[model samples]
Target chain A: MTAKATAPTPAPSHRGDAEWLSMRERGTVLGIRAAYWLAIAVGRSAMRPLVALVAMWYALFDRKVVRASRAWLLRVHGRPAGFWQVYRHLRTFAQVTLDKVYLLTDHTRALRFTRTGHELLAAQFASGQGAILLGAHLGSYEAMRAGGETTDLPIEILGYFANSRMINSLLARLSPRAAAKVIHLGDDPIGVMTRVQDSLAAGRFIATMGDRTGLTDRIVRAPFFGQEASFPAGPFLLASVLRCPVYLVLGLYRAPDCYDLHCERFAERIELPRQDRAARLQQWVRRYAERVEHHARSAPDNWFNFFDFWAAPPAAPPSPPPP
Target chain B: MSQTDATLEDQLKRLIVDTLALEDVAPESIDTNAPLFGEGLGLDSIDALEIALAIHARFGVRTVANDEKNREYYHSIKSLADFVRARQGEAQASAAPA
Candidate 1:
């Protein structure tokens, strides 16, 4: 029997209420399987109309996703997002998602990439001291990964995958080699850290998302797109603890068949002194958030965070005014 | 608990307090059996990493990541002390001879 779908209510009550981790995957396994095989068989160019249909389906029926896309587009464009704009946003997401199939299947010969700041990655590789690749949910990280694979760079993905198990497993099956490179973050904190340290020591890049926070993640608020939003401090904190260089990498999907891969050295090392640890974390996280904002604005349709990005924490009870 | 285990736990408590710069929390006030994460002390994974680093630096015992018993070993001050002591024993045994 198919699992009953539970639509997540978007009411902002607690921090977990708006957390992306609490949201369920949108499509069904059977539907995803069919789409995957269809994309693989008919190729990306032929699947555009079908993908648009799927994106349109979500845009029309999935009220939560539509509301989120509209809100995000409004913030970035400084105007109410029209229905087509939201549709385009979802369509971009769908197109990028479809590309992951080709990316993982070793069929990247057809893909084209224009990389900026590639020398930064080259320098780190030459130094034999692996760097952390900090990316966001803005664009297709898989594009960057596919590029790394082509260039013979050993890149491992470090992420939490509980939410997208179905798709992750499907992609894993498509490319066991790529899936083997994943370091899943789970209950075993020590295990994860040890593996990360070992990978860095061995000069393998660890790519992780810096935007979304897990349910129990420590967070710091940063101003993004003219409003304060919570960003996870874990990525910055891990960078500091690992004492490694960090580089901001984004693969903006240009329509049709091109990806503009942008890479910039973010920091040599993030230092969080005990005396001002919280402030230091805030500074680093804010800087990262600013970088994400810059890219998100440049490629507004590439923005993929389909949640209430600006949900404020539950309001504290007001105190009596001084007499 | 033996006196030495108690002493080790106290030492770890002080190390955690100092390493994490946990303001408003006295080392002695920390319960030996109270959870260090998500509840009693409310420490998170970052804190766990900090503690692991400090434990390695102070005790010369590396807390191997990916160990199936990491969750158990890092559960509390007492458990951490036990983990350190066991690792120290293993180190000594290995360094002794073939």
Candidate 2:
């Protein structure tokens, strides 16, 4: 049964969740606009040093975030991380965030994007049988959107905004068209399903992140980075319900203005039978985790989840015998 | 129920119980009109996909892959039986000479 939330609610705050929450709340649209205009005027070449300086400031002041980044980098890199490594990690995130200004403002002429497996998306579009693009927070999702604009395929993002009120208005102000494509998960579940169905039926691609989960979102445990981690079940469920093909898409930020966009066909369709629900779901989740880990290892800093990812969960007592 | 149709329904009911591992619910106890999903048998999207696979395996009839479109066919045992019967009829007619 679909959980009862027609509207987005506050995601339970873990360290990682809080970082995302605070990052937006700490800065206003005006501030983002100022950075955008500055980058545009001086060019990314001139803005690099300034962005690094800002990244350094955050790394120094935000102890919690730095610790989280440092811990993740250690696992991803398989080596001890120093202050400079952590700083670079934070800087990568800042640079990508700043680039959104250029991306949304229709000034991405300088950024270079190389896409692989784009033919899969093209084929899906050509067939008028749309597919689901399951993405993660590892890189610049905006780069994918930029590519979508160029390819002329309609892309709608499915996301749950914890502080959507503020961000939504900013999105409306910055790019009204972009704001319209967002299918907020916090809205009514049935409404979300209907809208998603319409989009798929119209052969438009729906982009959703498979990495994160909402406060109430049901999740399954899978092996990630050599340890079991919780991954959200919503993406697979959506694919099964839609009966659509699934594709894995990632836009890895390479340099100042270069990104490598990768698209891999994940599955023709998700077929989960009731008899082995847990095991079947686990297999799919494991495959996704392995793929994400492969990408994250290549670009360690681009992995945006800044939390104690490997922390142990609260204890669970043994279950009673079944009836 | 006619012998042939009764056997078809009984076969489908058995498949549902076996594929879904609903061990507690006996095949004969499944009300043909009782819903198979949410608020009925309390199945979810995953369960729906599984049932589709089971249907394909047992009857050699391909249910429409899209859940939105498949809702009518999967609504209950009666609907599923009718869907299978219709498809099997079409297959037989196409194969027979005029």
Candidate 3:
């Protein structure tokens, strides 16, 4: 007799009640995957019409995503967002997703990147010290990876991989270099952290996104664009324990087959004394939010949170009366 | 507990509390057999790494590449302090004007 399959236990989440958090693998659309292969067989220029068609279809049909897009655009642009503007935002997202196939599948000819702040990364590498490259959904992290591939530094990415294992394995089969570097974060936090420590010890760059909260950790709430949002406390805590420099890395898509890879030093080192752990966590989280807001203003279409980022924050626990 | 082991445990507890910046955790309150990971101390992988670093800095012990053995060594404060003491003894013996 077949034993009943046990249901998987959901990891505790410290994120806001944003609808996107419930969705699995936003980039796993079958049509998009098929088009990616077609773009590979033909050129990205030939695939443009298809990408635009797909983007337009989503803009017209997916009301929730379009509405979210409009809300984010209005918030960033400081003005009423028009339908055409929202459509452009969706189109940019679709274009970036399409470019991922080229970036990850080893089709490098399609991308032309202008890099800044790379000297900071080079200096960190030269010092024989590991660093945390905190990134966001605002741009192509794949481009950042591609740009850094030329350097001898081994780059490892920390991301959720349970739902995308099949797709990840398939893609990894196509690009072994990218596959070897991923340290899956969800299954076991202890395992992930130990592997991260190993990578840092071996002088590898540990890259993770700071904008999205992990599903299994406590969040540090901070103000984003004048509204409260929750950010994961893990990376910042990891930075403190590791006592290493932290840098912000973004790879904004500039044009068809072109991107501007930007990197900026975020912190010399994260220090969390026992007396100031709470306040320090909040301070660093707020600083990260400010940087994300600044970048989102410049590339209005690149903010990929696609959820109600300004939702009401959870209530803080009451403090005990002073003695 | 012997005076030496008690002192080692106290030193390890202080090292852990300071290195991890743990809140609400006093060194004297840490149990000798309490696990270093997960539910016991609520410490994650980064804490394990920091503990490893602290052990190296204070006792000149390095974590091996074998993850299973490392986990055994890091199972509890008692296990970790024992590993450090043994390693220190070995180092001292090897360097004793041979």
Tell me, by lDDT, which candidate is best. 1
CAPRI category for model 3: acceptable
Score residue A225 of candidate 1 by CA lDDT: 92
The 10-residue segment of model 1 chain A with minimum total lDDT is A1-10
**What's the DockQ for every one of the candidates?**
0.44, 0.08, 0.25
Categorize the docking of model 2: incorrect
- lDDT by residue (A76-111, candidate 3, tens digit) is 778888878877887787788778777777687767
Worst 10 residues of 3 chain A by lDDT: A1-10
Arranged by TM-score, best first: 1, 3, 2
Model 3: CA > 4 A from native: A1-36, A147-153, A163-172, A177-180, A255-257, A313-323, B1-11, B21-23, B33-40, B59-98
Q: What are the per-residue Cα lDDT tens digits for candidate 1 across A122-191?
A: 8888889888999998878877766563356778777765434565677567777763366667647777
lDDT (10s digit) by residue, model 2, range A254-300: 86678888889999988776668678888888999999999888888
Clashing pairs in 2: A6-A187, A6-A188, A7-A186, A8-A186, A273-B50
Name the lDDT value of residue A44 in candidate 2: 73
Off by over 4 Å in 1: A1-33, A148-151, A163-172, A177-180, A314-323, B1-6
Model 1 chain B is weakest, by summed lDDT over 10 consecutive residues, at: B1-10
Cα shift from native, residue A199, model 2 (Å): 1.2
Say which prediction, candidate 1 or candidate 3, comes out ahead on DockQ: 1
